[model samples]
Target chain A: MMTLSSLPAVSQAQAPGLPGRAGLGLKHEHFIEVLETSPDIGFFEVHAENYMVAGGPFHHYLGLIREQYPLSLHGVGLSIGGEGRLDRAHLARLSTLIERYQPHSFSEHLAWSSHGPVFLNDLLPLAYDSATLQRVCEHIDQVQSTLKRPMLLENPSTYLQFQRSTLDETDFISEIIRRTGCGLLLDVNNVYVSCINHQRDPQSYLDALPLHAVSEIHLAGFAEDTDSLGDRLLIDDHGAPIDNAVWQLYEKVLAQVGPVPTLIERDNQLPAFSVLLAEAQQAERYLAQVSP
Target chain B: MSLQDDFAAALLAPEQACPDGLFSINGADPASRFAVYRNNVHSSLINALAAAYPVTLQLVGEAFFRAMASLYVQAHPPTSPVMSEYGGALAEFIQGFEPAQSVPYLADIARLERLRVRAYHAADCQALDQQAVLLALQGQADLGTLRLQLQPSLATLNSPYAVVAVWAVHQTEGGLATLNPWHPQGALVLRQGLEVKVFAIDPGSVAFINSLAHGNALGTAVEHALEASTEFDLHQCLTLLISHNTLTHLHLEQKVSP
Candidate 1:
């Protein structure tokens, strides 16, 4: 079991989270529990937006606790793959947060959340056409230039397919990386979830991805239910413990992708810190066995 | 419309249904696939709002927050991908909002919560010391015509309700539902080190801070403080602001000679 005391010493100037270990998304409910008990998770991940408030207890705890653990600012907003021009105010806010925490790795979804004045809070799907691809790449370029750091773009979990999408999802991601030199935050659960939703093979989806471009792997629990047609449906709920299928998927990906930073994401119904640490330890075990 | 834009519109406003080309199922209706994106958009947004205003959720309960968030999502959806900055205007909406009228303090809570969010994401700056500020103001004897600077992370809000106590209670371990209407309170929100904190300010501190926030200099702020209460201690307010890192940059508004 990797312990906090034994983990790499995190410097104020260093990127958050020690390399080649598994982490858990730190929810507000588990703040003191994780801090007081000091769980042996590899590191902790937080939504960049959660701590984006001014002087409050959230920052108070994060500031103190972040001193001991490597932290990553996983952003769900900043829709990097959106069609509209990047919101400067949002970028400025994100810049302030990045400077304050100096997280290990900054990441956002490869989907748009905004349309003009209305922001659809979900990671809405984007067409995988060449024109859309160029727009996303340009947006990523703008973000990287402004932040002066490469941001990892996570593959989104999709429910619907677009007719105008001229490019495959894998090819779109590959082209994005080739153009912008950005890293990939590949969520394995998302692959399985999307695969089941789209009636595709998860293995084929994962195999098609540019594994070398991946800087991180995300594993989380999904709620399994049956569609009206009795087909298996997987919803990436992140509210439960890691499911066996997702774990097995993680192991398979680990075997191929080798050791990358893996995060166990549990956003809702967050359990005790030990519960997440145990989950992280499970991923750590897989990371150790991977051919790093 | 571009495919992405069409998809975005369809997801946000399910009434603006997608054409059959977006997804073609062999045996299913189009709404089945559209429902997935629709559900995703609603649930994800509800979750985001819950995360943003946990206290508000706690105040109204999950079911109510979800219903309210769903309505909020329809009326005012997120304009930015950054979820933290998404619900800044929620408090304002809750003010004119009818369903939440019984909980009059809810809007103030949302306002305070938004302030807390803004302070956390505000720019980073080093606070100036009292000595420097005092020296800067040494030559200016005109007390009423002075202006001062507040920190980027500092936000001040006044409320007839005991919003500070209300926020404080929800923050504490056993204080979730303990609401006391007797004590009127105000809040001074700021980020200290890496954390955002909210301090309950008395009437004098509120007046002094508001004056400074209005670009009034130290002398004018002190004057405002004195008018509120003869016992208003400017030094105490100054010390508190300095200690909390509420003042980051110092500036003087040029005096307009009459």
Candidate 2:
């Protein structure tokens, strides 16, 4: 029964926070290339669950790569918005990973992915109400306390809204941050996708969030589809290049947040490492324009 | 049911109506929008399965695999958040699955792939050096009473089908055309220097390794191997294990001197 308290304290000094430059999501295909070339990207982000295995090439490469660059661990399966109590075993595994890698930042979605023993792989949406808000805040608190560090909660790119919802998504996110004292990951692509899907202004949606608390930003691509009424529905597929509109939204975010650590996220249809590097460099150009 | 309870249920069951209280702003049907979540859940899980059992995917082709995997996902969603650990029951599911029965060896292939996945992520342990192993062998102790500890990543599979040959052919371009996949086979799967390698072994070696894995003494394991196959060669098995760096430690069981 290895509990968080039972685990030995991390003896090494904590790694520095993510630099205010562009980073790319670390992929398996690029592990050897990254080690061989040692690109000048700001940091490498990995889905925490991908490296949650006991031992393997994922750990081997991550250990070597972590020595060179700061790391950001993004979790896709924490179920932060689930109605049930948080999963202790999953939290313990996360604690172990954080101690082993000493990632500069840790983040999970504001959506839930598991229900009871069943873990749905996608980040599912939640109803934005007081009850949902309270549960999300408690989950965030539990995660933060268990990991002994603040975690960023990324806003989800949801397809539909709940009719029972009584609060705006931004208000709900703001309330959670206010209560749990957690930072915002500020996924600009999600804001654009969600706002467009719901027929809301993306800029106003961004303005509603607590931008001062944003520690990182994620920029990714989306797939467009139409709903029953022929309204444009944007899906955050992360399979294509970052959309021009999304990149424009990112520029707006950079102007406001002033060079927060940003990531060019491509989970599917991953191109060559050089292609992703080019996207990160594009973000670097935007980051450079932001005043200190 | 609660929102999540209903939501999770509907996500897996397309026949079920969309969960209540979900709406689209432009007065569009919620079911269509809800379909996105359902699609994401199924496709992402199917993709995870495809990634895990790539040879299984290639053998059955994408359409059939996705159809079969969708049923498996609905029946048994992952219990753990770790995606790599998901689909452990797929082999068992494929055994009972009627459509996959056309490919009689698919289940065994699934089993081998699962072992490879497990071996890839199993805990790391340093292999005993050649010098240490040689010293243990030459020590003035009865080799019969000595037990061998194997690496955590080591695993053995005795199958009724030529799983190793089938799996090996899929790794390359076109060896499957002239190969026989019906003969019984044994496989040894272990990670060597971060790469997981699968080797075809004799029935004797499979029994020997399984016995050792079950904590039997060297003498007892040899007996088991000989019982499984008359052609069991102790020296050959020892050489293979040693060369592959499978043995991690050797322990001697002390006997009272009479």
Candidate 3:
């Protein structure tokens, strides 16, 4: 058999242009369709953990995709918000992937998904205390220095809150950006979900955000599961189309911060490629109206 | 305990109260708010396990698999964020699970599935240079010191039960043939290009492959294979491994100083 190693390395050396106004989370199911059509979009975002493999179909398809569209490496596993020290092995893998992909924007959540050896496989919430804040800042600093590039921290849609948190979620994110000099990935869906779950105002929450630091934005669908009191609890499941409320919130964010590299994320029950592209086109239309 | 620890534990178990210093806004119930996380954590992990071990889930039926997965998540949460790399211990957990004691081959099936997932993600490497191997085998090229390297994705599943047949039958929609649990079966998991495949082999091939996998010289591995089975065919096994591209690199013996 021919050597498989040489097939991908040659092309991975060249860098694609950075993403523009709108992109979508590239799923494996849509790889073939994407290659066939080559739809119009700013870029495609892939989970850094999925492509952590040595080499194979993942890289093969990614190589083909990277040749055409700009790429963004979005990480869900870093657990930057945790009190535990960052996993050096995981960080090493991330560094290698960044060097290989050279994605336009490298972003991870402002949430903890791991504690010790146990990986919960979810973007978990954290208490925004001074100690936690310091821990998060140190982790971000390490990640930025190790990656040799400024990273963007995505705000997560949390279900619970900690009374110990003296800082509001926005202030807490702002403080991290201030200390680490990292950019922000403002997810409109997360803002709407966190506010609805906490009975806080979404507009006011967006108003307090460090939008200037926001280099990217994410818009995804959320699930509406009821709480014990029969109240709606928004879960950021990313299984459906962007809701009308979230779209309006995206409009508000665009009105405030103008255009940013926004992504339409749909992880589960993925629709046809055309569906995602249309949503991305919608984002482009909204972004077009802005005076950036 | 710290708030993070309590919060982590509470997500797994609902009987445990919300973490210290947790409160709901607008007088909403904190437990109700916290339940969202409990739902997300358990369901997402359960879904991931279900996706990885669909055959196991299929064999035991969805209802039982869900319960087993729920219990497994509580007993052992993931230590790494690679969801595909998670659930390495599910097969072990299933062996002790009370409700799953009936299907004795269930754990092995889970193991077979796990190995396939690992092979799918394992590192890529080039296959053995067949021309050099042919030349070395044809000549009297110090067989005692000839070393072989298999692909990193290669694995062997040695089981007392007919696991390969049991797994194969489950792959299609058809009649459920009787699988003799006492029948010994050995299967070699191979990866070609991008996909992984499992092939049932005889006891001798398993013995020879096991020896080679542990870095034994071809001559030593052949001896072990002969000991395992009188009719061991070293040439045929070599041909099979080379054909399947399981053996990636070969190292012939060097000339020793007189």
Among all candidates shown, the one with the greatest lDDT: 2
Give the chain A TM-score for each candidate.
Answer: 0.91, 0.94, 0.93
> Whole-model Cα lDDT per candidate?
0.77, 0.90, 0.83
Two-chain complex of model 1, DockQ on C-alpha atoms against the true structure: 0.33
RMSD of 3: 5.9
TM-scores for every predicted model: 0.77, 0.96, 0.92
Worst 10 residues of 1 chain B by lDDT: B24-33
User: Which candidate has the top score in DockQ?
Assistant: 2
DockQ of each: 0.33, 0.82, 0.64
Query: Which 10 residues in a row give candidate 3 chain A its minimum summed lDDT?
Result: A6-15
Q: Is candidate 1 or candidate 3 better by DockQ?
A: 3
Q: For residues A1-292, could you state the per-residue lDDT of candidate 2 as single tens digits?
A: 1121221212111124577788999999999999999999999999999988989899999999999998999999899999888999999999999999999989999999899899999999999999999889888889988999888889889999998999999999999988888888899999999999999999999899888777889999999999999889999999999999999999998787677788999999989999999999999989888734
- Error (Å) of candidate 1 at residue A130 is 3.3
Q: Mind giving the per-residue lDDT tens digits that candidate 2 earns over B153-198?
A: 9999999999999999999997667989989999999997798999
Deviation in Å, model 2, residue B11 alpha carbon: 0.4
Can you give the lDDT of residue A74 in candidate 3?
93
Each model: TM-score of chain B? 0.84, 0.97, 0.91
- lDDT-better candidate, 1 vs 2: 2
Please state the error at residue B192 of candidate 2 in Å. Answer: 1.1
